[model samples]
Target chain A: MKRRRRFHIQPKHLFLILLAICVLLIASTSYNTFMTHSIQGGFSTVLLPFQKGMNRLGGLVYGKIGSIKELYGVMEENQKLQEEIGELRRENTRYQLQLKELATYKELLKITDEYPDYDMVGAHIISKNSGNWFSTFKIDKGSRDGFSVGMNILADGGLAGIITSVEAHTSTVTSIIDDGRSVAAMAASSGAPCMVTGNRLLLQEGKLDVTHIDKDDDIDLSYKIVTSNTSSEYLPGLLIGYISDIDKDTNNLTKTGKLVPAVNFSRLDTVMVITTLKRTEG
Target chain B: MRKPVFYACVIAAAFLLQNNLFAAIPLIQTTPNILLVVTFVTAFIAGPKDGMLVGFFSGLLLDAFFGGSVGFYAMIYMAIGYVNGFCGNYFYRDFVTAPVLLSVLSDLAFGILVYFFGFLLRGRLAFMDYFISIIIPEVVYTALITCVVYKPLLKLEERALESSKRSAKRFV
Candidate 1:
C-alpha cells in the first residue's frame, strides 16, 4: 500500500505563529506608555523626509486653492479691512496700555511664575488621522527635540492638546476635543471646578461637554474655563474654553454644559509644545 | 516591475498621500482611507498570501505614524486583506462592484473594531451615536474613493504582472 499523503501545517509552526502574534499584541498595547520608543523613533526617522516633502506639497495645493477663493472676495474684504484698520489702530493703543498693566499685575502675583524655565518648541502639524480629525495628529518635533509623553501642546489661541507618543523626530498629539478622557478644569470667575470632556455628538456643533459643576454654582454663561490646580497632567491656569448652556442633572447635584474649545482644531497649522513637565513635587 | 520593490514603493506612496495630500483635501469632511483602498486592491489583484503581506506592511506604516499601538492596525488590515484576497478568484478585471462592496465591508469592520477597542472598552458606551455619525460616513467616503482609484491601480498591476512574466521567461 502506498504511504498516505497529508497536507497540514505542522503544530510547531502554528504554535510559533500564535506566539508571534501574542508578542506583537502585548508590545503594541504598551507602546505608547512604556516600551518600543526606540523602534517607533526609528520608523519616524525614516518617514521624516517623506513627510516634510509631502507637507510642502500639501501647503502649495492649499495655498493655490485659498488664493483662488480669495480672488473673488478680495475687493469686498479689502474695503471692510480698510474701514476697520483705522478704528482697530485706535483700540490697539488702549489695549496695549491695559495689557502692560495686566502684565505688571501678573508679575507681582507670581502667576505662571512657578515654572520659570518653561520653554516651548514649535512644530508644524504634519498629518492628521483621516478617520478622526484631531483625535491624533503628528508634529514635526519629537523626542530628539526633547519632547516626551504628557507634555501640553498649545496653538495660537490656547491649549490645543497633549503629547501622547514620541518618536525620534515626530510626536503624536491627541487634541482635547477628541472623544476620549476628560480634563479637569476650573471656572475662572467662581473657581468652581468642572471636567471638560470630548463628546462626538457635541463636537459637530463645534463644542465639548463640561461636567461636574455644582448645581447651585452661579456659573455664568461664557465664563472662561482653565486647567484646575488639582489636574495631575495639565498645568494650572491654561485656558480650556468658555462655558455655555448649563443644565442641571436629573439628580440635581451637578451641572453639565457645553464649552467652545479655545483652539480652532480644524485650522491648526503651527503648534507649540510646552516642554515643561508638570512639577511632581506635590 | 520587480514585484517586491514595486509593492514597497506603491505602499509607501499610498501611505504618504493618504496622510498628507488626501488628508488636506477638505472636499469631504472625513478623509478617504486611501491606504485601506490600496490594501484591498492588492488583495484583489494578487492572491491571499500577497494580500496579507501588503496589508500587514501598509497597516504597519499607518501604526508607525499615528497608531496608539504598533500591531492594532496591522492585525486588522492583515485580516481584511486575507479575506478580500479569497474574493479575488471570482473577480472580473473590469468590474467595479467588487472593490466598492469590499471597501464598505472592510470599513465597517474597521469601525466596529476601533469603537470596540478604543471606546467601549474604555467605558464610552455611546455606540449608536458614534456608529451613525463617524463610522457610516467614513464607510461611504472610502467606498467613493474606491470607485476613482480602482482603475489606475488595476492597470498598474496588469503592467507589472506582464513585465514580471517576461523577465521570468528571460531568466528561464
Candidate 2:
C-alpha cells in the first residue's frame, strides 16, 4: 500500500514568512520607494477625519479637566496678572520711545528690511507618536496646504521644529528636542557660532545642549541664540533659545552650554509653518 | 469573518485612543502602551494564530501613522504576539496576576527591542540613560494600565467568541 502525502502549514513557517515580509518592508521604506510613499499617503488621507475628530474631543476633555483643577489657583493668578499688566504698561511707553529713536536711526542709515517677509500658515497638532522614543507629531496642514518637508515650524515666537514628512492632509514635524536633531545657531549679540543639539535627557531640565562655540568668543548668559545665516536648512535670525550656562570643553578649543528654549514644547497646540524653503545656491 | 472584523475594530479604536486621547492626557511623562495591552490580551485569550494576526495589523497601523520606518514596529509586535500566545494554555478568566505580570515583561521586551534598533544601532551608546528614562517608565505605566484594560477586553473577546460559535451552528 502506498502512503498518502499531505502538505501542512505549520506555525513556524508562518512566522518565518511574516518575518521575511517585515524585512522586505523595512528595506523598501529605507530606500523610500514611491510605492511606500503612496501607501502611507493613502492611509493618512483615510485616517485624517478620524484623527481630527479625536483630537478635538481630547482637547475639550483636557480643557475641562484643566479648568476644574485650576479653579483654586485662578484668583491668585488673576491678581498676579493684574500687577504684571501695570508694570508692562509702564515698560510699553519706554519701548515706544526707543522704537521711535530706532526708526530715526534706520532712516538715517537707509537700511531697508534686513530679512524678507516669510509666508506662514497656521496649523493645529492632531496627534503625536505613541512611544516616547521620538518627539514627532502630525499637524493638520499637509502637502495640499502647501506644506513640504524642511519647512520651519515656529511656536511661541521661537523655532520649534522642521517638517519631516508631508502627506495629503497631514504632515509630521520633528521638534528640536528630539534626539539626533541639531541646528546651526549663533549668539545674537556677538555672532559667535555654536550648535544646538537635541538630547532628551537634557530636555527633561527644559534645556538643550549648545556646543562648539569658539573658546575666545565673548558669549554670556545675556546673549540669545538664533539660527545662523550659514545654516543651509534653517532660516537666518530665527530665535532658538537663550544661553543659560557655558563651559569650556576639555579640548580647550570650544565651549559648551545649556540653552533654555523660548518655546514651551510640552504645551504646544498651534504652530506657524514658514512655507518658505531656504533656497540652496547652485 | 465576524471575529476578525470585531478584533480589527478593537485594535483600531485602541490605536486612535493611544495616539490622540491618552497622548493628550498629561497623566505621566509617557502614556501607557494600550495597543500592546490589547495585542497581548488577545493573544493570551485566543491562540497563537489570532494573536499574530492582531499584532501584525496593529503594528502596521502604527508604522503607517508615524513610524520612521515600516515593518520595524510590525515585526516587534508580531513577535510579541507570537510569544504571548504560549500563555493561552495557562490563562484563566479570573486570574489577574498572570496578565499584569505578562504585560510588564512584554513591555520591557518591547522597550529593549525598540532601544536596540532605534537607538543602540544608531551608535547611541547610552544604555543606562535610555533604559532608566524611557524603558522603565513606559514598562511601569503599561503594567498599570493593563490591569484596567484587561477585563473589558476579555469580556469583549468572550462575547465575540460566543456569538461566532452560535452563528456557525446556525449555518451548519
Candidate 3:
C-alpha cells in the first residue's frame, strides 16, 4: 500500500459513505427524545455519585490550600486597609467621608433593589471540572434545596454560564470557557455590540477576538463589556470583564474588542446565583 | 476464541475503572486515556490485529460517552495500537521510561487529531487554548498516572495470565 501520495478522493463516493454511516449511527442511538434523555440519565446517574465523591475529596484538599492563600491575601489587604484608615483618620473630613459613604450606599442599594424578588443562595466551589474544566465548575448546592437548570450564576464581577445539569446536591456552572456558551455583549464606552464567545480555541492567539468590529468606532482598551440586557440570557449590567484590546472597524459602524473577564477565574472559589431574575415585560 | 474474550474482559474492566475508580485519585487532572493506555499497552503486549481491534472498540466507547463524532476515537486509537504493535515487535518491552514517554506522545497526537477535526467542524476556534487549557494538562495528568498505575496494572496482568481463569486452566 506504500506509494506516492495522491490527494484525490472521489467526492460523490466519499460523500455517500459518510452519509450512510451518519444515518446508521443516528438510527441506532436516536430512539426518541425521551429515550435519549433516559439513556443519558442512566449514564449520568452512574457517573454522578463518582463525581460527587471525588469533588468532596478534592474540595477538602483544595480548601486547605485556598484558605492559606486567602489568609495571605487578607493580610496584605489588611495592611493596605490599615494605611487607608490612617489616612482617613488623619484627614477627618466628615463631609467628604459622608459623600463617599453615601455614593457607595446608593450603589449597593440599587443593586439590591433591582433584584429584590430573587432569593440569593450563595455557594462555595468545591472542585473544578477536573481536567479541562476551566470552563465549568461544581458548587456545593443543588435542586432539592431550590437550584435548577438555566439559573443565572454570577459572582462579584459578571455573568457565569447557566447551570446545564443539576443533581440533588450540586450544579455544573458552564463558564464562558465552555465551548457551548456565547454572550451578546457591548462596549460600555462606544455602545458597539458584538458576540462574546467562550470557545478556548482563541486562547491560542493568547486572547479572544470580538469579530465584525467597526473600524471607525471608538474602540479602546479597557472598554467595559457587559451582557446586553436587551437580548441576553444574562441580566443587564452584570460585568463580564473589560476590553483589553480593541479591533476597530474604521470602515464600519460596529466595533469589537478583546475581553478580559473581570473575575479571576483561575482561582474562583465562591459564586452567587440569581435564582429569580425574570423579565416582567411582554 | 478464549484470547478474544480475555482481551474483551480486560478492556471492559478498564472502562469500568476509568468511569468509576480513577475518580478517587486526587489532583490527577489528566484525561485518563483509560482506553488509550489499555489499547497501547495491549497492542504492545499482544500483537497488531488484537491491539487495533481493542483500541477501536475502546475509542468507540469513548466517543459514545464524551459526545463527539463517533468514529473519531476509533480512528486515533486504532492508529495508536497499530503503531504500538509495529514498535512492539522491535523494541524492548521492559524499558522503564518507555510507558511515560509513549503515553505523553500518543495523547498529544490524539489531542492534535481531535483539534484538527474539531476545527473543521467548528470554524474560527482557538487551537492553542484547547491544547494549553485542556490537552496539555490532561496529558500531564495521564503521564503522572502511568507511574502509579502501571506497576499495579502490570502485577494484575501477571496474575491474570498466571491464574488463566477463563481457559479452564488452574492458577499456576
Q: How does candidate 2 score on lDDT?
A: 0.86
Candidate of highest DockQ = 2
Worst 10 residues of 1 chain A by lDDT: A2-11
Model 2 bad stretches (over 4 Å) = A1-8, A72-116, B169-172
Better of 2 and 3 by TM-score: 2
Off by over 4 Å in 3: A1-36, A63-114, A117-149, A165-173, A188-191, A201-208, A213-219, A230-232, A250-253, A269-282, B1-35, B46-89, B125-141, B164-167, B170-172
- Give per-residue CA lDDT, model 2, range B1-172, as digits (tens): 3798999889888988999887776645688898899889988988776777788889988888787788889999989998998888976756789999999999999999988998888788989998898888899889988888888889889889788877767655
After TM-score superposition, what is the CA distance of residue B144 in candidate 1 from its true location, in Å?
2.2
Candidate 2 residue pairs in backbone clash: none
Q: How well is each residue in A1-282 modelled by candidate 2, as lDDT tens digits?
A: 332224556666777888898999999998974656676788888888888888888888988888987986898799898989988998999999999999999786543322347888899998888787888889988999989989999998789999988888899899998877999999888898999999877877889999888999978885789999999889998889998988998999988999999898878889999999988796
Query: How well does candidate 1 match the true structure in TM-score terms?
Result: 0.84
Q: Give DockQ per model, in order.
A: 0.44, 0.50, 0.17
Sort the candidates on TM-score, descending order.
2, 1, 3
Please, what are the lDDT tens digits per residue for candidate 3 over residues B4-121? 6767777766665564334333334344767777887776666666567777767655444443334555566777776676666776666647777878888888778767765536
Model 2 TM-score? Answer: 0.87
Clashes of 3: 11
Per prediction, fnat is: 0.43, 0.58, 0.07
Runs in model 1 deviating more than 4 A are A1-23, A26-28, A31-34, A73-117, B26-28, B166-172
Ten-residue segment with the worst summed lDDT in candidate 1 chain B?
Answer: B22-31
Each model's TM-score? 0.84, 0.87, 0.65
